[model samples]
Target: MVLLVPRYDEPRLLAAEMELIDQSFGIAMLGCALAGFILALGLSIGGGHPGAFPWAVALAAACALGHFGRRAIAERLSEARAGLYARGMTALLTVIGGLWGLAAWLYMDVHSPATVICILSLIAGMSAAALAVFSPCLPVAVGFFVPAIVPVWAVFIATGDSAYLAMFLGAPLYLAVLMVFARNYARVARHAIALRFANVELIARLREQTARAESAQHEAEEANRAKSVFLASAGHDLRQPLHALGLFVVTLGRSELSDKQRQLLAHIEAAAGAAREMLNTLLDFSKVDAGVITPQPRAFRLQPMLYKLENEFAPQADARGLFYRTRDTTTTVFADPNLVELILRNLIANAIRYTNQGGVLVACRQRRGCAVLEVWDTGVGIPITQRRAIFREFHQLGNPERDQRKGLGLGLAIVEGLARTISTRVLLNSRPGRGSVFRFALPLTSQAAQPADASAGTPGTMPSRPSLHGLRVLVLDDDPEIRTAMTALLQSWQSVCVAVESESEALAALADFTPDLLLADYRLRGERTGQEAMEAIRERLGRVIPTVIITGDTAPDRLRNVHAGGAALLHKPVVAQHLHTAMTALLSESGWRPEIPRAAGMRMHG
Candidate 1:
């Protein structure tokens, strides 16, 4: 007889079952094999009883082989959900194993000898039932009733003898014990089935929740994109009329009209400008939120721009009964111009807006090689409790007698984004109803600053204007009035102006014209934007023209495209001086320095 041994991996493979029925089946097979081996060894002390040994050997071999085969069948059939086949195979093999055990008991004639074998079979079946945990209730009924009736009927078959009677009497007790064990096993299986169903339901619910969450996330992204689109379309549509209105307003300002009428016109222009500013802010915020506005770092004079802000805002503060000032020595910094403008505009605007009956002081000084710019105010301060919360969108606080509609509550938020662009930040210091201070440091330039302002101890500075005298200018816009206005404005500064409407018109003009500058509107006809149009123009010009994208579109994506075009950007209702300033600054490398001061020729009020 072969002494078969199970491998460790056998248990590993079978252990996939949650209830481990395979484990129970393996243990039963092992028990049967052990009993058979004992039977073979016990029947023959030496070579005296060869026939007995052979009989025992056959039984032992059958038990071991049947056990191994049965377990294999169960494992294969379990995956197929072939419950009936598994039950039949288990019962047939288990009966054989029990017979082998019974023969061993009979050979030895141990008192109540069949009891051990019967108990062994019972234990195997019960263990299997217990581990199965979730079998149908009908199967549990069949397994218990069939086995329980077996010994009871056997005792009745030999009822004549007194010993037989005793066995028959004890049969009912054994049947009762099996009934109890089966009921308990069934209960466990039922409970396990309940838990399994519960788990399945939970997983289904979890999947549904995850799907909804993903759908909501997609919707949020779409909404943000829609917002950007709406802003762009609205801004573009309004710009044509706004540009016309702007020209008319300027003309009206020059009319021999009443003081109140002039003031009314100024108010109209101011309101329009403020609306335009809000639109731009929204556009920038959208681009930033969409992760398209990247910092375009370049070397520029920080002090000059800072000083310009101080001078620009001082009159406004004075009109509001508030003082405006700044302090800075270092001027040069390598950073994005657009981002710097965004930050400084918001910070200074806030200082002036918030300060009442007090002064706003903006100061900058050289720290190491970097410049530290600070804005201090003795204005109505931020509450200590709400200092952190103030940065949130649309959040505003109430003072003793609060102004209902103040700023858009996006000042500090814009400041945060602008600071990130330049790698310079706004640092805040404030006490409720006392004052607040906002400061940020900037990197210094390698070139030494001119000596006049080093020891002068002043931050307010008049902007140093550059000459743009013989600068060749090309302006492309769809509107006839805007093109005429641009041409008139540029020619007055001794700059040649060739204004066109479309790509075809521009090409025709280019045939006779070799201009030094190309200023184009971002949106042109025939599904072409300024970026593409300028690219074609640049190719024809055989040089990267100092191009500027002038547009009124406030869409995040459109603005992003303009920024990526590597051109200086200007948003409309364009003032002639602002246009000239942008053009001169960009075209100054061509050595076409204009002698006349363009700002001197224009008039404006804060």
Candidate 2:
């Protein structure tokens, strides 16, 4: 077997060099301060003025300050920037110090070589400390050369007047001391330079990381805003088409039509139903994710929604030849309506989906004095082992592939999500291939869930086709058909709606653009989008206006952009009920009922 030896990598080399640099500077600074203190103490004791000692102390203090300051300055620059200045400062300090030493030696005839060497060392240390006051790199060069030069100069001057034999003897000792200091200073200087480079690089990286984090935060906020706008806009667009379909459904139900036509209408109604579910789900998911689905405590009817659920699921259960029934007829509950209905819808759908022969039973019971709804189905029951894991996202039991007949595995997940929002819990009791019982507990309220009551709960039914008799609205879209239908709907609601083809057309109407509300499509004919149109119109109107973006695509990215553009987004296949409610709400007369609560784990069975 061959053994492979790992070599020192570049980062390790750089780090080692930097560590050497900082440690060397720190040691040198501290050592010089001690040496200066001792020398100045000796001088003052030996008849030198004590005033000079304070100056020595000051030098020590200044050196200490410079030491810290160098670290700080090195951190402030990017690595490349720090390295550039470091190289320049290092050269400058060494060259200047050497010249100054030469000049000093020429001018002074000092006899006490030790004192002279000490003073020169102090001067070099001081210079090293000061050079880096502005540029940290200078100290690196000062550390290496200063220790060698001052002592050599002292030894030469000391022996200048002495014998040649004495000069030869002192020269070797001087060289030895010079080499020690030289090596120490050299290592220190190299490490310091490397450290500065690393520190600068680290600082640059940190700054870059900070910038990226800030950008991501900004995008997330914008996405949330866009979601809000989308919910408002989507509710409106989907509602308009749904409302039209509802009217047509009502009309078709009353007409003397053939059995085949009735079946066709049923299919239309089912498609309409699926579309509406998607719209609601989009809003629900956004609200939950955005932390906007705050649960409000209010006493409202729960029985009405339940009774409607019974009627709604009755046909489906009958078609499946399964018995679907509920036990309790209790009503009032103090909980979020929007959330409760969502739970109920999931449980019912789940029960109906898997029931092969037996019927599903829906019942409400008073448990621990709290109203709890239970949906029991004679369907393919969940296994005990799989029950705990079922509530997770995309978890499906006994299903090989996610087929079209079965919806996404969000039913129970959503149920769980919504239930948690209202302090509710979903419980499941089942055996594989036997049957299942999904029950959720919730709080009760004062209002009865009856259609006869005017203010028991959020209105379960769609908004009535009331007169928009004297209202004014602006419809902007590049597509002609969309413009025409929107105008027709607004006109039928008794509002004056102007159909425009582009941002220019809308801008052309800016002189008279203040038409209560502005509706624009996301994609315009030219290089313009609805956001641009809304902004231009708002500027002309001289105030922030309420605007909605009607779009055919509901892609997350496009929705995110819509948020950036600061406009409400609405997906296509607009229904009248949702549109009217959203429009009315935007206009400050919101009448749309929030969702009702059901089982928390209802979404888990998806």
Candidate 3:
């Protein structure tokens, strides 16, 4: 493998050596030629050797011409022809070196010993310069030096003097030293070129890897977006039937039923509740992932919020035969009230669900300029190993059978996501078989505590049913089941309901009966939305009635658009009691009356 690798790199090394030689060739040739010309002119004029002067001039001219010719050919030479061009350059340099040797032999006879010494020194200097210039290619360096120096040494050795013989002896040693220097320099140059090529290849590979990584990241993001779209569509479709079923269940509870039937209804209701919870968890995760939950921060009294939470979960804890306590604090907090409530709700709910024997405690304390809200429970505590994993989606500790009553594992996940949205941190302290304490901090505000309203009832409490008798309400929904179920529920409440499927139907209904309120499903059929239907109905009726937008879409953009319409918004599979509460509030706030003349044919559907 090692031998093959070097063989593969041999061509590149040779090319690099040739390139160095080619680049320096012309410059070195012209410089040496010019220096030799000046020296020849000085020696000939000083020694009065007119005969050798013409030869020196001719030699300089030939060298100048060779430089220009080599430069012109180098410009035209492509990589495929570079080897041929390099050999030609080597031959040209050898010829120039031979001319220098010939000039030495011819000029030495016509000049004194001093002039001869000067000429020999110039020739030696030129030979050294050639060695440096052609070192990138050892064969070319050898070609020039051998012919240039050997003839001078031979001429000197022909003399009988000891000094001449000594000069001949030193010439071969000098040649040998120059050859060693050239070989070392060539190896170094080849190594440098190989390193440069390796770096270029490395950089190219890194760029390719970076591009591939970015492409993979983009594809992952696209797939995630598609998943969100699918979930939103599927959730909406699923919610239509569930919404109608919930309303029907609530209406059935109002009717008389036998003991067996009543138990069956209770079972159905429990199943429905579980399904709704799982669906809501999926929707919440999609919403968080889509970044739809925007925080509306405000200053609010912590005591009232805690009291509300206590009231909401107290009944559930009581049903399970467990005590629920809340330690009230007058401290005010600066945060998004809704998000804070949601985080605490999830934490308390989890605590209540996990605890088999003991009660849950909700407490607040002023600590380090913040109100630290804690939910402590004496339940089956979490093991240290499983603490971090508990907050992950769908990760339950003790629910291998997936019990509905034990709850889906998304509560803590939702809690973490909401806490992050509100810029708060959730801390956990627990030991297996002991209990768990979940704590989160809220910044305390200097604002005075807003007194809790006596009129404001506990969370999840139904309002006193206001008189719906003779009240006209318009409901626009695309699903017939939901439309029929809503009409039945509203009529049961003694309200005159006009339910329609599309904008055209709603407009026709509006012409016949003027409604005091508008209830709409956000997603509708055939190039129209519930918001547009409501607007069209209001325009036809010539009055602004109170509106409610119910949706199952958890897509961020869709949710934000519906919220921006300035209507009371509700998500699908909504609690029937909460639906009624919202309706009561909107109706009471608007106090709107039917203004359009009622058509004689306008009759209420049961």
My TM-score estimates for the predictions, one after another, are: 0.60, 0.51, 0.75
lDDT of 2 by residue, 315-411 (tens): 8889988887766575567776657877888889988988898888887887786888888888899877888787764577767777746765657
Candidate 3 lDDT, tens digit per residue, 20-120?
A: 77677677867777767776776667776666667667767767776777666643345565666567766777787788777777666522677777777
**Would you list the C-alpha lDDT of every candidate in the order shown?**
0.62, 0.61, 0.77
* CA RMSD per model (angstroms): 10.2, 15.1, 6.3
Best by TM-score: 3
Ten contiguous residues with the weakest lDDT in model 1 = 1-10
Q: What are the clash counts of all predictions, listed in order? A: 12, 52, 0
| Candidate 1 lDDT over residue span 1-606, tens digit each | 111111111222222232344435556456545655554554444323345556556655665664566545544534344444445544544455345434433342324445434443543454344324312232423343444345444545444556556555655555455455545554565566567668888998999988989999999789867766876787677776666566566556545889889889879978867765666666566666556667876667666676667667888888898877667554666567557766777878887788777898777777787777777888889977887787765466653344534666777877887677666667788987788988888776656542222112233222454555556667788877777666655555556667788877786777877767888888888878888888898888888888888888777667677888888888776654566668877766655555454442221111
Off by over 4 Å in 1: 1-139, 142-191, 247-265, 286-341, 344-409, 424-472, 491-496, 511-514, 538-545, 564-566, 593-606
TM-score of 2: 0.51
Name the 10 consecutive residues with the lowest summed lDDT in model 3. 1-10
Q: Which pairs clash in model 3?
A: none
